[model samples]
Target chain A: MNLVLLFPILIPFATAVACLLAWKQRHVQRVLSITGAVLLQASGFLLLVSVWQSGIRAVQMGNWPAPFGITLVSDLFSAIMIVMAGLTGVTVLVYSLADMDTGRESFGYHPLMHILLMGVCGAFITGDVFNLYVWFEVMLIASFVLLGLGGEKAQLEGTVKYVTLNLMSSALFLAAVGIMYGAVGTLNMADLARHMGTVKQPGLVTTLATLFLLAFGIKAAIFPLFFWLPASYPTPPAPIAAIFAGLLTKVGIYALIRVFTLLFVQDLEYTHALLLVLAGLTMISGILGALVQNELRRILSFVLVSHIGFMIMGLGIFTHLAITASVFYIVHDVIVKTGLFLVGGVVRAERGTYEMSSLGGLYSSNPWLSALFLLPALSVGGIPPLSGFWGKLVLVKAGMETGQYLIVATALIVALLSLLVMMKMWADAFWRDSPGSAAGGSVVSANPVSFESRLVLFCPIGVLGLLTLAAGIFAEPVLTVCSRAADQLLNTEEYIRAVLGGIP
Target chain B: MEVVMSFVIGGLYASGLYLMMRRNILKLVLGIALLSHAANLLIFTMGRLTRGHPPLIPPGEVRVLESIADPLPEALILTAIVIGFGVQAFAIVLIRRCFETLGTDDLDEMRSTDRAP
Candidate 1:
């Protein structure tokens, strides 16, 4: 069980080292990455079982105990995150194998992918705030390399903006950490939660909380801080873009949830009200951006920002049910959003462009591709009997319970807008007719024998689609675990005792 | 001493914020550096300046403590300094590449490629 906690981190780190050593051998790197991702998925599942059985477990490094040393803790929340990350890691690795250009493969793309996975896993499991910062940097650096791997004109241009904005966020994060350390005298989250309770200065704590919120909010692509996401996410290759869209921003949300619930619950009225306003504005603005965009990938990227507001809204209400709903929504969004982006990638690869204005009739020429996209699209739009519907239902129920009428109303409106956006994508990309439809029809006829590429592409999307369905069908068990995870987060005494050996 | 350090940190942070808002990429990188330095100094000062103490007790002395300078803040500052150096290095390289490829450092000029022609 303990070893399971370490595998997600270690497997990727080992594979990253191997990939770097064999940098010149593209095939070797690909094979190794795929194998590592599979192993990581297995390990993640095993860790989930252990977490379910034993409750939250903590592993201290160098045997130095908790507050003074780095610790990796795995509760149900972190365990579930690892599994999702692993699943996405494998899907993206396979997609990249088929989708990445041969010339670009020679330039360490697989290595960076593995390193990014390492950072993702590390961030989920880390119990210390400083270690969280370290993992964030690790992930950002790898993303910077991956974003610029092709060195194309647009890639370079996007990389500059991405890197600059992320660097500023990182600076803010460091500044927050410094302030936190100065105030609390410890960096361990559990320890800080205890110390924060003792601090008498409300102004200082609120200031620090705001600083942390700004930093993580930028990463999470929440309102007013989401300008960089739509600008830069579309410039990367589809596989890279898909994973980033799926996972990276959620890391910030994860931190936000952890900090607000465990450490800063003293001022929930103020913080929750602020988050409510931000979430409302983010939802409206993001969907408007999506509606106005004609490009397929950029529209999807903006939709990602809008959907993020749903999760934030859930957290703002700050109920047990609401947090659970937020957790469920995040997991559902990660799978459905990434699957949609990969489908977009497939469309681009076939049509040689992502412009909705220039693409059409894919449904007639490639019914399987069209069908493949329909499941995730409908799921993301919160259709019933899908995972997305369950999350939205939970959140809406929680909102009504809490009497947050305005937030509930805004959420319903956004959900409708989301459906419209997905339908717009489906209509333009798959249903409408264009001048190149005739040429596309003939090209598919000529390529009647390339089932391997199609299989390779569809397998990952199929797995994700199935999981989305299964998660919806089996919402009972997943929700149970989420409820427990939320309970643990809200009950800070258990976490403190697990880390620091009983309250003084 | 505390007042002087506080002023220094404030000045650095103000300049850093100004630079960070500039259009030039190099200026942004420098701004991050200045901001980090200010943050580190602020953390150092928050430990509360105490003279004539080194945070170490003499060998086998039974509770002979004389208000040492807070060692934890020093350790935090060291770690923060190292992390800042790595991020700054990465930013410098990124800025150089941006200047070379974009042929301009002005952020406003880098318009969206997908904008309707």
Candidate 2:
């Protein structure tokens, strides 16, 4: 077993423990957390380099062979997600240092943050379906506490919705795993894929596919299941929301992509077609909902839900270019959504409100903030020459090739609406004159903000913003990596061979 | 055995979803617990039911001599139970805290986070 695969998960776990040990010293915890985050990023990049150079990497626990023992595997797709997780970890941790109140900080925020990161990285790397559920639970438990850490009424309220819905999804996911295990007599993903077709009941695979879809669908926040996200996301602090927005749902999409491409390929016509229909409805419902939201985070959350459809569309198309585009979209959305949330944090810090009605004059009072917000806002909203556009462009190309022009056209229309809505936000929040102190909403930043505090708060937003810009401008290289990752996904023999000794 | 377990699982799920639909938050948590238990049992039943043969290996034997109960489902169930216990315990405490803070048991009343001011 190559120990290199363990580094991404280990760094966060170690940092979390260190943070716990230095619990009383907030400064020490802060430094340890940042170092851990940076190390996580470095390790992820290192793994990506190795995977890119070699093929997929897999390791069995305790030197046990594949089918019986647990497997931790990373292909190009998983490695790229790890890199995104690490990047979001560093950015959100830095942002939290400034954005979080002392009450939450003193109450073990840093350790929980690292723990959440560890769980996310685990979900990305685990090759067993059951382990994925465990990782999701780890993430859920940590996030439950983090969401309700301060125990404020709104936080508790939001946590209730988040926790209940997520727990239900976990139950469904566990049940699916159990059934799949029973049907196939294996839990290793590669082995399951190998044996998925041989189940005695003819329709069992498709039924289980639907079960998996429903389970992951809730997590991914597709149309009907997305109500929890907007309700809960805006209730949390911006940094926490940033982390959740950037990574959590993307994990679900990753699972969907993983299983649909590998384990559930027997009935692509039914499952993939269903996915395409859901993608269209999801894109429409989510953006239309966003069109009416009055708060910054609420709007962004809706936008987040809508773009999930775009990724699902890629999976639905099930082509090399489409999956590549989907991967690129995931990469792009993670950074943009996180950055936009941090922008919300900064806006709240400066203007003391998230309600769009009361926000204005940011174009003059804080040009940097406006610029930072505009970069991600436009990127996610799919302006030309941006990261979002390249992903969308390739997705349209795939849709055209597959002759699924209706969904392609729907995607294009939704992209336009998203752009219009984002631009409306920019105009309402930054361009229009401030409604002044009288019209301000009740919610305000709990963190103390001063001119000097700008550096800490802006650091993550700036990093994420610049990353969005650079990822857009350098789309060629990233697209190459994504296409390779997509190829690995579509051709599962490579992944299976890496995990289960020899190819079956 | 599968027939009996099927009824049992169905009953648990039906009641769990029923409780989950109620307005009370405590019942909601209880429903979640019931739902997870049902899932655990489903896994147990699916692993196949064997009466007396335990998945034990005689000393130095390469493998089990009989078609023993598959230990994999039990192991998976144990892990799920532990995780479910942790989650449910935390959830109960959180619900209690919610009751204390909000001074209400109704889930609908806690709509401040859902609705924009």
DockQ of each: 0.46, 0.74
Q: Could you tell me the TM-score of candidate 2?
A: 0.97
Per-candidate RMSD, Å: 2.5, 2.1
What digit string (tens of lDDT, one per residue) describes model 1 on residues A207-289?
Answer: 88888888989889899998778888889899999889888888988888888888888788788788888988898899989
Model 2 stretches with alpha carbons more than 4 Å out: A437-448, B58-63
Error of 2 at A249 (Å): 1.1
Cα misplacement distance, residue A77 of candidate 1 (Å): 0.9
Name the 10 consecutive residues with the lowest summed lDDT in model 1 chain A: A441-450
What value of lDDT does candidate 2 attain over all alpha carbons?
0.91
Q: Which stretches of candidate 1 lie over 4 Å from their true place?
A: A438-449, B49-67, B113-117
